[model samples]
Target: MRVSVVICTCGRASILPDTLDTLTVQTQPAHEVIIVATQPSDIPDLTRYTAKMPLRVEFAEKGLPKQRNHALNILSDQCDIVFFIDDDYMPSADALEQLSRAFAALRYAAGMNGTLLADGIHSRGIDASDARSMLRNRPAVGPVPIAIKRNLVGLYGCNMAYRTDAISDTRFDEALPLYGWQEDVDFASRVNGEMVQVNTVSGVHCGTKLGRESSGEMLGYSQVANPIYLSGKGHIPPVFLLKLTMKNILANHLKQLCPEDWIDRAGRARGNRAALKDWIRGRVSPDRLTHVRPSPSGPKP
Candidate 1:
């Protein structure tokens, strides 16, 4: 299979190079690496990597879904599988190789999400050096385990792959705007076949907090509004949406008491309230995030 890697990023120039460096050592090299950035400066100098791999950089309007759709529009015709990975993720050396094998075996799968050896998104965040160390020292494992769970709702956006043909008629929903919290779920649920999870195709999500363009308010609004929007669209069950909505709102409130230095819990809380109000007034929409103004005083410190 001819595999292409797509990375849609913005304001992550500082750490994106580390992710690119790992790709250089992949056991199964990608046919091409397409990077969609909002501006030239959003990506670091790539001249150094031009010789190591087939790399292409393109500019797009800011917004994760929009940037990803831009990549889909320009994908190489020869590409059979397109892997979407975050700018902060680091795949193991054989990840692509294993992913290809899994896809070959599961002929009916439309998409697949790789196992994450270490994910720092839930916590403070992980250092690139530390993430690299974890990847390097991970214990030798058994055969790759691939499963096609009928109930799988979505692929993890940090590291996921899809057959090129499966998405020939699909595009990431631009309605979800920047960060696009549940865009992956919305996309996967709309595609043609089953989604799988493969253990052998693993990676580390450093979840670097820098270069994030979404404010806590915007993210919080997305946390509530996107799920509701998707559920209403019939992409996700209403029960799942309700569970997700309450979980996020409850977490934000509980965390506000002793907020992490890196997180703006107060801003998120305020945004949550705003979204609830909008919902009650029948004005809730993910697009409203584009109109959300930043807090003048910034998030409570």
Candidate 2:
């Protein structure tokens, strides 16, 4: 099958080199490479990398839907399948081939989830050499040496593949959430498909410390708010949303163990206040109550 690998990157040129190298060496090389460089100049050095590579390069304008949606809209017709891998990830040589094989083997499955290998370190930069070291032993999460499958809640956006036809029919929702959050979950929820976790391709998901957003950015807020929005639409329940938000907050705090940066005491307090306020004012969005009823056709796709 002709597969196009889609990578959406924003201002991370340094990491692309390793990502490109891995792609170039894929056992099942992608038919084409379409990069949605969110920033026009984010990859000025693209020519240098594409010079000796067989893959063709393409760019997309950056926006809220992010590069994945941009690439899908433009390239879906050109490729049979579209595989997305993060700029920071290094794919196994056979990752592409395996993902395709999994889909072929499981005709009913719409999407397959690939495993992630986080280094657990926050600050150090990742490179090709580091990827090789991590790959030598094929860590537990490193490579899906065998093919196993199961129904899944969703696929991790960074390392997943989908038939082009699936996405061509309905592009990812741009208005769902932003700042690297929930696009995958929300997309899977809306798309009519059976999700699967597949034991196919696996590779080191490199870690980074310095360049990522610090605490000041309301990443936590978006994580919380997006679920709230989804719940209001009846995609999820309020209690479940609260549980997830609190769990996410606690997990981050546990990882950092820094109260000032991790403890969201005020957020907890404000959450209660907001709930109380909504209850008192009867100002819940219509979606939270009346709109949740199934459509005439039944449950939404």
Per-candidate TM-score against the hidden true structure: 0.95, 0.76
| Residues 1-301 of candidate 2: C-alpha lDDT, one tens digit per residue | 8778877776677767778887777778787887777556566476655754555445655543556777776774887778877777788777788777777777777777766554423334465687767665664533323335555555677777887777657666565433445667667666667777765567777754423433222344455555656666564446756787678656544644443332343443333334334546755321222122222331101
> Cα deviation in Å at residue 266, candidate 1?
1.2
Model 1: which ten-residue window has the lowest total lDDT?
292-301
What global local distance difference test value does model 2 have?
A: 0.61
lDDT of each: 0.86, 0.61
Question: Model 1 segments beyond 4 Å from truth?
Answer: 148-150, 297-301
Candidate 2 Cα misplacement greater than 4 A, ranges: 51-64, 119-128, 139-149, 215-217, 236-242, 252-301
lDDT of 1 by residue, 165-264 (tens): 9988799898898888899988998888888887678789998888775478888888888987898889777887789889989988999898887778
> Deviation in angstroms for 43 in model 1?
1.6
> Best TM-score goes to which candidate?
1
Output the TM-score of candidate 2: 0.76
